[model samples]
Structure formats: structure tokens, C-alpha cells
Target: MALFRWGHSWDAFHDLEREVDRLLQSVNLSLSFQGLRFGRQYPPVNLYELPTEYLITAELPGVKSEELELTIANGVLSMTGRHISPEGAAEERFRRQERPRGVWQRSISLPDRVKSDNLSAEFVNGILKIHLPKADEVKPRQIPVAFGT
Candidate 1:
């Protein structure tokens, strides 16, 4: 009944890990980050499909129209932007930085080909809207059946 006991080394290791996490969280640092890709999907977006087009909307606070990049190729739409800290404010002065403060990029695939020439986008009040018009071949067409004359 007592031949084997719980491992003390494993428990000690976990305790040390918890302490390290606490210290890191207090300072708000990325202990495993290797650049700006901090494992979070920034600028969360929503996709909607309509009868004539597809719409994509995203909330991009602190990002201006000139600061964002949008591109579509090979049935995929990509968005990139950066959020900068306030002017004259140092990083050390930030008590908490939950929002990303660097460049972030995200991409999504389209269901079908879209009319690139007819595409439109608008940015107003920190909101981004992109309209992807459906291509001619992809649009649903109504066919009338011939009736007896």
C-alpha cells in the first residue's frame, strides 16, 4: 500500500512554474514571444454572405485608414495593421497593455471568386467594412420554365 509515493520533483517543478508565471504576469511580459506574433488574433472580424456580395467587418481601434493594409489574392483576404502607443509615452509607463501594440495580420478564405474590380471598402469611426461582389458565374440565376402557349 506504500510501495510507491507521489513524485516530489514533479510537484516542486509545477510550484516553481506557477511562481514564474505570477512574476511574468505582474510585469506583463511575453516570456515566449519571438517578435510581434503573440499568439492572438488581433482585430477580430465577422464575415457575412449576401445574395449579391460578401461583407467583412472588423473593429480596429487606434488604427487609422492609412495605417491598415488589405489584400486579396488566391481566394484569400488578408488584413494587416499596427497599433502604436500614445506619443511621448514610454512602454515602462504602461500599467497594463492588454491590447496589442505592434503589427498584426490575419487572413480569411473566400467561398468563391469575387469581382475584384467592383470590390469596395470603407473605414469610419474605427470600423472597417469590405464588400466583395460576387462574380457573374457564381451568382445564382433564376431560370423561367417555358409554358404552353
Candidate 2:
């Protein structure tokens, strides 16, 4: 009976460990200090790869295009900008502030080298979509298979 109890406890501990790992993977590793998430970037992003190009979509609800800066260097694409708060809210008291404000920079690594010159970006409906064309050498190709007798 004791051996069985120990085995159940060990399994429970492993399950808890896996749950913690999953939660950590989904959230940004940021330290909360003084009611502020320091060194944390707002607006989560999603990246997808199509047949010809790679698409990166980021959620930027209140950020304007004029305040955004996009750059790609060393195979990493970076988007940096500041979220403008209300013009005059210094004296206002907030009940619960969930939306992140202030300057943020998010960098994503690319799987392959892309054509930077032909890259296109569009911001519409609070979503920023960037289309990066894969280089010719990196694009997949199908070679004709010659079956010899």
C-alpha cells in the first residue's frame, strides 16, 4: 500500500510540473515590479509560412502606423513602437489597467532568408500583417524524377 501511494504521488508531481511548463510557454517571461510589467512587450504576434511567402500578423489595437518602426537585420524581424495613452490622464485613477502602454519592441526570428526589398506590410483593423517573400534559393523546388530502365 505504501509503494502504491508513493507511485501516485510521483505521478501527480510530474503532472504538476508539465502543467507549469505549458503555462510558462504560453506567457511572456516578464518580471512584475511595482504594479508594472517591466521589460515586457505588449501585443502578441503570430507567424505563418505559406508556399511563397512568410506572413507575420501582430495584434496592435491602439497603435498607429506613424508610431511604428519595422526593421529586419541578421535574419530577425523587429517591430518597435510606443502605445500612446490618453492626452491628459495624469490625475485619473484606474480601476484595472490590462492594456499595456509605453514603448515596446518585439523581434521574431525567420526560418529562411527573405527578400527584404520586396517585403510589404499592412496595418488594418488593429492587425499588422507583414508579407516576406522567401528568397529564390530558399523556396522549395520539385525536381523531375527520371526512372531509368
Over 1-149, each residue of candidate 2 has an lDDT whose tens digit, in order, gives 01111244478676665565456545744543222333334556777999999999998888788999999988898889998877767635666556677888888888899998888899989999999999998966799999999
**Model 1 agreement with the true structure over 1-149: per-residue lDDT tens digits:** 12112256567666665565556556665532422223336666778899999998887866888888888888998988888778998879989766557888899888889987787889878889999999999877799999999
> For each candidate, what is the lDDT?
0.75, 0.75
- Candidate 1 — which residues are off by over 4 angstroms? 1-40, 142-149
Estimate the lDDT of model 2. Answer: 0.75
Any runs in candidate 2 off by more than 4 Å, and if so which? 1-18, 21-41, 91-93, 141-149
* lDDT (Cα, 0-100) at 102 in candidate 2: 83
Record all residue pairs in model 2 with backbone atoms less than 3 Å apart, i.e. clashing.
none
